[model samples]
Target: MLVSLEIERVEPLADGAPFGAVGAYERVVGKAKGEVDPAAPGNRGIALIDKAPRNASGKVEYTTDIFILRPKDFSRGNGRILYEVNNRGRKMLFGYIADGPQGVNDPKTMADVGNGFPLRQGYTIVWSGWDPDAPRANMGLGLTAPVATDSGRPIVQKVRDEFVSGTRGGALETFKLSCEAASLEQPRARLTMRERAGDEPRELPLNQWSFVDARSIKLRDGSKPRPGWIYEFHYEATNPKVLGLGFAATRDVVSWLRYDAAALAVTGGPISHALAIGFSQAGRYLRNHISEGFNRDEQGRKVFDGIHSHIAGVGRIFFNTPFGQPARTGTQHEDHFFPENAFPFSTAMQSDPLTGKSGSLFRGDGSDPKLIETNTSTEYWQKGASLLHTDPLGTTDVTLPDHSRVYMIAGTQHGGRAGATTDAGPNVNPRNPHNPMPAVRALLMALDAWVVSGQAPPASRVPTLADGTLVEADRTGFPAVPGAAVVKVTNQVAPPGDWVNPTPPAKAYRTLVCKVDADGNEAAGIRLPDIAVPLATYTGWNEYKPPYPAGELADRDGSCLPFAVDAAARQAAGDPRPAIAERYKSGADYQARVEAVVASLLADRLLLPEDAERYRERAAKEPRVAP
Candidate 1:
């Protein structure tokens, strides 16, 4: 294996504070190894993967980018390394409060480093580019790979491309992901119109569209497609990038930082322990990394001591493919099906009753590290978070390993906002004000303590079918709130397949959703102090309007409807639920309720003392309840 690291550039970050600011560096890691096959099962990704023929050196060559954020003085830093897996070239896990658009380790300026939380924590942070398509400016990184081919001829393959119109327009302009043009100008095109997930799909004829350029497609009659309609084009695209190498590249980099003493010297001493944190797309990547056994390096040593997977749900990314689009996280209405949601859905090793394939994410080889997996209420309705705990057949619950804990942040959307009230998000749905980051921060501290002091983290708390909290989606007892889009909360799964010609063994497996109480709050999962002491009805599902179906859960958004200020308002609406005033004698009483919830969580080891006071302050400042 030709695994090597080179420092490209180094600069000071964050004005060189007490830890003397942060020392940021640009790096390139290249590996020379035997040729790899993209079709092999576990071999889907291995080491620093290469798709092209080995050079005269008799080794395949591949290079990928990485950005390291360390203390100027290594002694001033926490000996731990936090490898943040980037989602489409953006660094997550820091959970920063940025001044504007910010990339976590993006060089040039860590100026407005959003509260600089990570900096204060003293952990060395690292970001690397595994996606080849990522741009270069603003600290964007990428991997370099050769096009896969057979002999001297180009290897032709079928590819699937899904197009969703972001804006309403007369003509929709489409572009290819990895390839330049279609091998045959007109391949096979299919268009479908659907207002929502369960709505009947109306297919448009192939003759209605044609290719404008190698990548661009246009309507044949000079007309435009509907804004919410989904368009799929399976064309003969050439020069498919060896996208599978991305997973391998990421594995090698993390491995190098963990074990390579020389590489570790640059950041002070060797990493005594390492933790990986990813949200959404990046979260899925972390799941695949362990599920595929990428955690065991070439030397057969574990890479991370723990991983924090936030909002990933049960789906691993469709990251390995001929022309992989690492950024695409398919929703129900758009990009219907691809390889994003595949088998081995749960962390435990189990037999797929349908496919007869048996595998587990852990090796039991003493390399399976501890894990803290957190999700929001949105995941149950959208990304199939329930499936992670449930069996493939959704018959029984799957027992989690002792080292792993799964918590669902009740009544919040994916990556919720801070200090938000009943407000509309940038998406089509109104935003749920519930923020999971505070709970996330506390859990992370628990994870760190567990790793360092051999202390056990908090118990896993999530909705379960055994308990009435986890129930069928349609059975959630939601209260009547005007304009609340409380639709059937079920998983929308499709058959996993090849980009173009997919031969999935099954269409969709059993789906489960969490049960909500009369106030529309999820009954299962970790209830934050705010959730336990409620003001508004925080929910995990929202809806889209017109062109899109109304009651369908809006993509990754949630809803928040403030309760009636008094019993008169509740009676006026004919709503049976008691109003906020009826529950709490005064605003001070509400603050005490919030305090009790926080104290309970703190005693249970789920909330830190520092965070307890923070939550208390948060409740005290709630604008909705203020006089």
Candidate 2:
């Protein structure tokens, strides 16, 4: 027989409040106070208030009077309600309440103005399947008894460490109780950043930069045979001293699904979150390399050009370098960033290296300035494959042996752009259009289905080429290569100790100004090793264009952040719609696309007629929601 459970409270806690608290009742009162009209479709009125008195030790105790709703299938007997309670809102307390006919209602009451001594403030009903020996035929009110409580100490301590010392407890406790009642599971991913401390210089290798670790915890019960799985978290760090060996690693553990694994799914935030921290740390380290001059000049322009070239060179070095080469554990070098004999132009510039021209560049004397020198053929640009083929983050050492499936995506930026917009001024836009969440979710769903059923995922589960065509899978129906590889390593040559300055000196400097033209003037200032360049050459850079107002230049300085190009610009620039659309569509579309591609592989036989109809029907249906 099917059983339905419905719970209602007369004086309920606020939207987010722990049970049995004055604030909880206050929330209900607040809702009643804000009600414009009770008859409105969405209007809800508060039903009760709570008042607590402090004891001798100044600790407050509270009691709540709430009306509980009965389930439609009520069969009175010994009924119990399973729920959780939290302290304030921080600590989680899991427990149950029991009710019976013996302790029904109390007639001894206190009288208030305009009310009787004994009042029916609220009612609660418990429902269960019909039993021949049950005490009552119809539902009735009964006394309440507390059951077991789950400790909220761990969650409360974590919040205190991460946010404030004690402010978050109440909010967290209330959230926990509400989540338990609604059957929502907390996300189980952790984002952490690790940098070498001054005392631990020996622990980190010399010349290595920083290290970031993204961990997704998978909890499992020892009694269950199911194994744990941890997906690879990407890591990237750069060190100028360690030429041709920028570190990168990505590792995914193979294992069976556990209870928590089914509830807490892997999301895209871990990889990008770790990368954001790593990149910020890298940018701080590279501050000295930034150009020290502003405006167009014979020497300053050359310096700016050189800095851009250096950044491009760094990009080439990283892209061509492979993880774990030459030595097994000791320091090793790979030319993946700077491939042996291969030019760096392919990975460095937005324009063709051979042409020396950019789509954004205009014609005239300013075009193809002789000051621009091409480093496409530099030694740093050469390409050659690395000898090492093992996982960089040492996944094989930490992950379960049973875990097998691994997927990686490459060529995408660290964090995806939320939407297309060219307004990202000086800084790199956080929201790059190439966000990997949609694709990652699709892959995870495919993995889930593959694990639950005997069927394997089709090759087209991975993203298609820039064109709107499906990429064929290997004979095994899986992609031949992993998505992307990320590595984390410390600089072995110039350890932090080498540059440690216990008594750093103070600095003093002044600003310098120069004339740009009849209506413009350029200003320059020194900010340590790095030069500060403003958005406009003379504060009138773009001549008051569509994106600029009079006397306001598109500042490249920290004042104006850089943003990615948006959809309108992409379309105008001839970007293919299908290529971009596939990245954001729902999982159903992704599944359909994969199945369509799979159908093409067996167009001649039973695979087409038998599987096509079934797959099409499944694709047409919306994703199943959990009951």
Candidate 3:
């Protein structure tokens, strides 16, 4: 099904990589050379963002870079390619390293991180530049796109830009979205300020804010931007890039690599099957990619056999639109008005009773891939993950299709903290410390089995309304724990008009959080040993302390509070719950409890045996647990 594919070249990795016998090479996906091949219709698709004019070739030609890391010897490799789409500029391809010996921030042994598990497994890993604006020199792949314009005129659309800073809010109106152009004659823009997410937004007089460049918007007084306040500017932006092509690029590249048999000479053979994983923004991109019918190549062959979107809530991206800003991620405070959050947020088919519109996230092109979506506890609290499994009205559970599975990692933060302990991550996020990697590793294996061996993954472990497990945030059975705010997560809604303006959702969808047990751990989903046998009361929701959208979820980070060591301590803090010291006779007792929990998880197939052992071992090392 390939239009054209060239090996470009292959090179061995420098010494001291954790990849074992694996080698790495960079592949080049170039623009079409001769007549446009339908299968490699690089930019032939319509640009929904702008009715931009194109050349006689019919579409803009794009050339980009992709990287492959596989066994140097083709015979040693499995026929599977794990295509990990980058999230922004960072590589999560090795994030599972958090579960291994070398954790993040390992400069000296970064190559040896993750214990070479993926390499030893003989799976070939590949990644390509999808987002054109993804930092190239900053260690990200490169994507080049043709500029989009309307019939000889620059297409301009009202774009919303929001900036939040903890320390350095530069003094100037130079907030550029990727690469955009503001009007030359003093662009017209409006600025608004809100000290807290709950605070009433105060509109600044038009005279107060002006653009310094496409990148920055600042006060007319020339004062430095303040920390902890949200500065939002709504202005006319022009020259939107054909960002949606990035989606097609992913499809075409994978299709060419997986189906092009010519590669067998050097790479052994075309990959038998392919899978993709995207986290956060990239995850949302995947959602938009499949939902927008980009999973199939121009020749109509499936690109990805299986898809895993992680930490992406009820959102897609402003991927392809007039003045498109594919990088803008909608949040409660930052970029809060992007098109990422839209209807049909779930993969399950259900009618939006209000609009009487019904559909699922599948393309309906018969090329929909098997999907396995996973979210952390933070999603339920912040990202409306409940929407994935529940009806839009949130009154009942929407059964997942047999081909799709939804899993929620209990008591974890967004993307989960890596190598998390009872302590929170060093990053400023205040959420609890729940490592989602072990579960992620196990689920990926399940996804591979589902695609290769036709074995269904474990039954969906998401919370449900019928079971009383999925309930409103305020309804959680959590005891009155100190320093914990079981507050409601914002439900972003909108009416029909002025898509770019701040049109609040006319009505709120039913936002639900998971129910908790006596120990304050989520009881509905896959709970690793950390929650099953806990020392601290791990939580999915963490509060913004002072500045930075106060009272909102801490940008998806969690909070971990070790239960008071003793009942006296709990009583002094006015905590109604018992303490870890009171619950477990000693660390060994905690270890035994964790072991039992691990055994149960293994039996349920929620966790693999190897992962269960790792969990047990980690629990044993916790200061609260003894050998």
Candidate 4:
């Protein structure tokens, strides 16, 4: 039977003594010559050294002059000596003695230098071997003391005790025996910082950092005198708004080596130095401070054009969003995804006549009016183009002609929900309900394989409709909306009577109106509208028209009197119901709202009818799951 074997010194022999040394000669004699004497009782299987006694050295030592003798007996029924005893024992003994000094004595000297047999100080030699047939046999013969201090303890402990430590026996030994033994050389690390010609002021907090090295490496043949291993270090400022974050890279060292004549020790290598510079800035700066565009001469022109030009062919572009942008349909909101902006406002407001107004009154009409209808031909769309143009930033013109991979993680909050971002507060989403990290990792692995093996990645890892399960890479683009369910209303609007001023003096007025499907189902694709009521007195009103004049009875002076329901007002309406008594009942209101919006979109041809119908059916049968 084949078996495995392992051996270790559970309890090291004391007094620096070697293991199995005492019985070495006795075993050798037993194996070479079966028995020393046949007439002696109980000595049939015994060897000569078994009867030897310890000398003054307190240990058994085989004498160099010891020899083996074979008996001569008569043959062929005649008592005659077969042959005179030959002097072969002395001749064999001579060869053993001649080889002993070099083999045995030299090994003993090396052992003493390495700290008596496999251990010295606190360092112990550890090794492993296997013999298929003799599983239980000794397999611990290959262990040796560390190359550096064959007689000393680990350097780390020595350093802790206020003594200088050497790397010769630790990392160097392990590196040489493992990595270097295969003829692999450690690649020199290189760092390239993106900066302009002049010095730029920046600061990088060491605490918030990530070090990314080659996950797997392949060396190129005939590349250079010293080929470098590619690595990337990504560091984001804890304060997300702080731009111009800088970074510095250097080799990680344990302790410094000192040169001293008394010790006569050779230092391992020179300490690695660093290149420090800033890659980003809090605000935009020109390529040259004194360049043509220095004096605010190009305020209306694109701010990112120069930066994009400078970084054209340097390296791959990385898109980083410290705080995720609010979910929107198109790229109009992309520029606001960066940290420079504190809050999101519609681009239409940029050209508002009263643009300088404070508080929430900065946008739209001054009346805090909802559903204010305005023509799209105004400057609103133009402002959107300007703001949106800044989004691609330095990467606007960059084309990955090499077919470099692009990984877009769906349903992920910016900068990770828990990392170094201003949004990392307790109230933030604890976990991304839609897990996308797994998918991102799979994509990265695929890219790695593609780059290394010349294998093209699959057109899509996403599952077909017939496939039964979702894989990591399958969840690539966007998260599927959760099943439609009840929506919970945390905030409620007051009824007309409860309002500071009631219109038409009605007993029960509909303060909030929620439009549902003709079937009155609260599933997906149900529509909602603003609160509609009979006017106390109508000056003039039209469903498709706006800016209708209020009649004489309109309470224009009071806070709640001049209120009129409009399209914008319907879209911005808040929930007007109390919390459910049970926790499960809370999501009812939101479910109703989402269904209503989806229904409207379908009606307006914004969504495909088939898609709308499917979602509606799903929402009706089961609750919508949140992405």
- Tell me model 1's lDDT, rounded to 2 decimals: 0.69
Q: Which segments of model 4 are wrong by more than 4 Å?
A: 1-399, 417-434, 458-627
lDDT of 4 by residue, 168-217 (tens): 01111100010011111222221121111112213223322212222222
What lDDT would each prediction earn against the true structure? 0.69, 0.18, 0.68, 0.18
- Ten residues in a row with the worst lDDT in model 1? 25-34
Q: Which has the greatest lDDT?
A: 1
Candidate 3 residue 572 C-alpha distance from true site, Å = 2.8
For candidate 4, the 10 contiguous residues with the lowest summed lDDT are 245-254
How would the candidate models be sorted by lDDT, starting from the highest?
A: 1, 3, 2, 4
- Report clashes for each candidate as comma-separated counts: 3, 59, 22, 25
Which pairs of residues have clashing backbones in candidate 1? 16-21, 17-21, 349-360
Error of 1 at 68 (Å): 1.3
**Higher TM-score: candidate 2 or 3?**
3
State the displacement of the C-alpha of residue 403, model 3, in Å, after optimal TM-score superposition: 0.3
Candidate 2 lDDT, tens digit per residue, 229-336? 001112221110111111100000000001113211211011100000011112111111121111122211211111111112122111111121111010112111
How does model 3 score by TM-score? 0.89
**TM-score for each model:** 0.89, 0.20, 0.89, 0.17
